[model samples]
Target: MIDQLLDRPITDFIPQREPMVMIDKIITCEGNTITTSFLVKSDNQFLSGNRFSESGMLENIAQTAAAKVGYECLKNNEPVPLGFIGSINKVGVVDYALVEQVITTEVIIQREVLNVTIIKGTCMLGDKDLATCEMKIILDLG
Candidate 1:
């Protein structure tokens, strides 16, 4: 599974595609944490005037969490399930990302109950904080 993932883009692991796929690669996925990266570009769906919007930051964090789930599922020979952002709370956007900048996202799973996962996500550009939020992800287990 790692070999397959290594040869494909992040879109292969998550449901998002094309301009909507904010995360470019999975940096690490172990224990209860996941780290991912995305390069902000002019053609990104959430870009406005060469700047990555808050929505993109949120989605990137969510996708980072999703990437971890997807990787584990695939590694275990299970199908990748669909997931949705059920809720977001205590969101803090500290800065904006510009085109050509790479944003790194890290998410730690705080809790899981049935099909719902609660996570604390943070996005950064180098050492500068970009966004942070606590969100609930609802997985479609059917």
Candidate 2:
């Protein structure tokens, strides 16, 4: 089942639609960590002068985390909950990804309490780090 889910479109595991979907595919979701890949397209909204913006990197991270939750929910035959970014901390932008470059993001679940989940996300371009941050996501259970 997990292997089948990996072959499905990223949209099935995330709430964002076209143009707003930051991730292209889910590489893996194991234990408390999830990894995703995104290609920096020329027409991407988060592009800034042929480079992916910091905001884009951040969104990619958040979406990676969302994919994790969504995948789990689907596997368990449960509805995927809507979630929002509660806060972001310790953000570091090492460099921006150029257009056509593939950005890989990895998000690890740091903690989860009730409806709130804390995750640490890191974006990488091959061997170089692009951006990283810790984010708090609040799920709407009601």
Candidate 3:
């Protein structure tokens, strides 16, 4: 069963813990593309009014990319490294995601050189765009 292959929780893929771990699950992962989802809940740490703050949006994007990298490591039987968003550019928030809504995030790896990877990410709530950004992630391979 597919569940047998990906039985580990999303928390296993990223470094963040409760209150900071925003991504709920990894929906798909193929090559340079990864898709993850998060349910915007009333008890979420970033919830403001009915939605998440702009910082929360950016973290979601970064973590999506982190999930991709983590998945790759798991597949290769390597240790999952710590990574941080070194830079973010061209960020735009088109709409606010509300509580009780599920936000799907997708990230495509643009390029990687040495220990840095550049990615383009987008967050969507159904057909509406919530946010998009290009980020550079610095990986700690040690």
Candidate 4:
């Protein structure tokens, strides 16, 4: 089931549309961990000069988490729920990705209660860490 979902267009699993969409593909979704990949384009909204900004990396992490929820909802034949970033904590930015670079982000679910989920996300460029943060997402199922 998981293999069939891999490499598909990122829009299928994430509610974000073009321009605002930060992730390009879902690399893996298993258990409490989800990974995604995004190519930093020259015209990306979050780009400043040739570098992808910290805010963009943060959005990528959140979108990766959303993909996990969207993937599970798809598997259960449910509609994709809208989600918002409630808060962010412990943010650390070591570097920024340049244009044409591919960013790999990994999100680990920390907890889920009702419509709220807590996760830790780390963004990487190859083996180099770019940024990491713990985010709380609130889902709207209504």
- For model 3, how does the per-residue alpha-carbon lDDT over 1-142 read when each residue is reduced to its tens digit? 3634356799889999998998999998988999999998899878778888788889999999999988998988888999988999999998888888899999999999999999999999897888999999999997
Q: Return the TM-score for each candidate structure.
A: 0.93, 0.97, 0.95, 0.96
lDDT head-to-head 1 vs 2, winner: 2
- Deviation in Å, model 1, residue 100 alpha carbon: 0.3
Output the TM-score of candidate 3: 0.95
User: Could you tell me the C-alpha RMSD of candidate 1 in Å?
Assistant: 1.9
- lDDT of all the models against the reference? 0.89, 0.93, 0.90, 0.93
The model with the greater TM-score, 1 or 3, is: 3
lDDT of 4: 0.93
Residue 72, candidate 1: C-alpha displacement in angstroms:
0.7
What is the per-residue lDDT of model 4 for residues 1-142, given as tens digits with 9 covering 90 to 100? 5388676677878889988999988888999999999999999989888999989999999999999999888878899899999999999999999999999999999999999999999999999999999999999999
* Root mean square deviation (Cα) for candidate 3: 1.3
Which ranges in model 4 have alpha carbons more than 4 Å from their true place?
Answer: none
